[model samples]
Target: METETRDITITDIRKLLDEVTDPEIPVISIHDLGVLRDVRKEGDTFVITITPTYSGCPAMDMITLNIHGKLRAHHIPHFKVETQLAPAWTTDWMTDEGKRKLKEFGITPPMGSKGSEDLINRHPPCPFCNSENTELVSAFGSTACKALFRCRDCSEPFDYFKCH
Candidate 1:
């Protein structure tokens, strides 16, 4: 018996990649994170482009490995995962569904663009209680990309998915 290969379309590739999740945040897929920049075929080889949430993010290596593993699982033989850093990632790239998932997982998604004076005075509503009474405990949380915050109304400590 011999195995047959079929031409992979962008949708097919995306469907495969959709199963790849961010190691840190299991609730959201990498595709929802907006890290997956592009996927295309180049001379029978699949090319996957990704951007890290931030420079030196430890999760990138694992993400790349997972991409390779996923492609292999789909029986894809030749593929390349490339990292692009020119256009920095922003919280704006995150999908609304992703944000909802984050909130449901107890991580408050970015409220808006970072460093805005308006955003400075505002604290993200608590994911647990939806209270506006939240305080920034620390600028950095379990990960550099997140911040530590505590809700005054609910008395719950949570991580805020900081905007980039």
Candidate 2:
């Protein structure tokens, strides 16, 4: 016996996928993080395109699994998740809401767009005290995409989402 496929619109599927949050950062959704690229239907199959924040990002594997779980939970059977590497992902793709969420989550968001000259000299403000008197503790933070920073004012250590 064949099962009937539900006639769900692309918008609906996108909304569902938007519910999937980043495994590392639970406060932000994949869509907000700029990882989720596109959602479209190709014939009878639904295609979900995603781009990693960087090449060989380990989160991609867990993200794919989460996307699969979300779609499956919604009874979306005929779907395919594709990873696109060209036109590499950048912090510029991050949504304003996503950035705000990151700050609220105690992680400083990317200060400027990718390759911005101002970004070269500017330092990420401390999310705790909103102070510019922050020093880089390490080039790498909890994740490869972030850098560790310590705010002198607040005496707190936070992760800055590095621009790429």
Candidate 3:
């Protein structure tokens, strides 16, 4: 009698990748961030593609490591994490759940598309106070992908995830 081996499927790999979270933003999973682009199988090896939110995102290294670790933990022996930079990652790729999670984490989620001078210039509603009266204190926040903002109504300073 011959034993039948189960081939790994994209769905299975996605579930495992979903367990991985962004090192910087622990409140949301990478899956929700739309980082895990595509998964495929080549014989015994599984190839996974991902795109960083920014070209020079510092979290990409940690994110890649976490992805490998997660897959290894699940007994995925042969696999590779490929970085895809072609189309680039945009704020629009972020899942609705991710946006909600960011707001719940007290960080205002980005409202408009990336590189939209007019749109990005518009103040996003405060996550803490839900007030539109906000001011950009700094173009850069703790991370390059965020901007420091203060709500006039609540006088609370918060990070606004930049659209990129």
Candidate 4:
């Protein structure tokens, strides 16, 4: 029988990744938003795969740094951050816990696509009032990934997770 030693470990690094948060929206972890794809050991280094919420969303730089910082603290010295664009990051990939956290953070969760059309046709519920009487204030919110919404019942403005 022969003994083998693995120089790199991934499970621990992946666990520490939860500490990294979106710089713009601290309440959401990059992982929770479905941005983080995978972390694997590649020889003496690490391969981190991430998908951006949108093609040109500006939060990517900070997201990368946050992940790296967390990884480095966990002793993952050599790592590569790779961007994976397809099958692309979709609102559908958002987890139940992620949705609940978003609502608790005052952002509504996105519903599934209503049709074959590429546009986001489903109206998101208001996080504050949970009212369906919500209207789109604008398709673009403070961030390109989110839509601006107003709750008719509560007369409060909120960000809708509905996005293409």
Q: What is the C-alpha RMSD of each candidate to the true structure, in Å?
A: 1.9, 2.2, 2.9, 4.3
Reference-based lDDT, residue 117, model 3: 50
What would you estimate as the lDDT of candidate 2?
Answer: 0.87
Query: What's the distance in Å from true for residue 16, model 3?
Result: 0.9
lDDT of 1 by residue, 49-92 (tens): 99999787999999999999988877877789999997888888
lDDT of 4: 0.76
Highest lDDT against the true fold, candidate: 2
For residues 1-164, what per-residue lDDT tens digits would candidate 3 score against the true structure? 22121556778888888888989889898878888788888777788899988777889999999988987777777889999987888888889999999999998888877764543467889998799999889878998788898999999999998877
Decoy 3 TM-score against native: 0.91
CA displacement after TM-score superposition, residue 54 of candidate 1 (Å): 1.4
Measured on C-alpha atoms, candidate 3 has an lDDT of: 0.84
Error of 3 at 162 (Å): 1.1
- Residue pairs clashing in model 4 are none
**For residues 2-114, what per-residue lDDT tens digits would candidate 2 score against the true structure?**
22355678898899988999989999999999999999889878899999996757999999999999888878868999999878898999999999999999999997678
> Considering summed lDDT, which 10 consecutive residues are worst modelled in model 4?
113-122
Candidate 2 segments whose C-alpha is farther than 4 A from its true place: 1-6, 116-121
lDDT per prediction? 0.86, 0.87, 0.84, 0.76
What is the TM-score ranking, best to worst? 1, 2, 3, 4
TM-score for all predictions? 0.93, 0.92, 0.91, 0.86
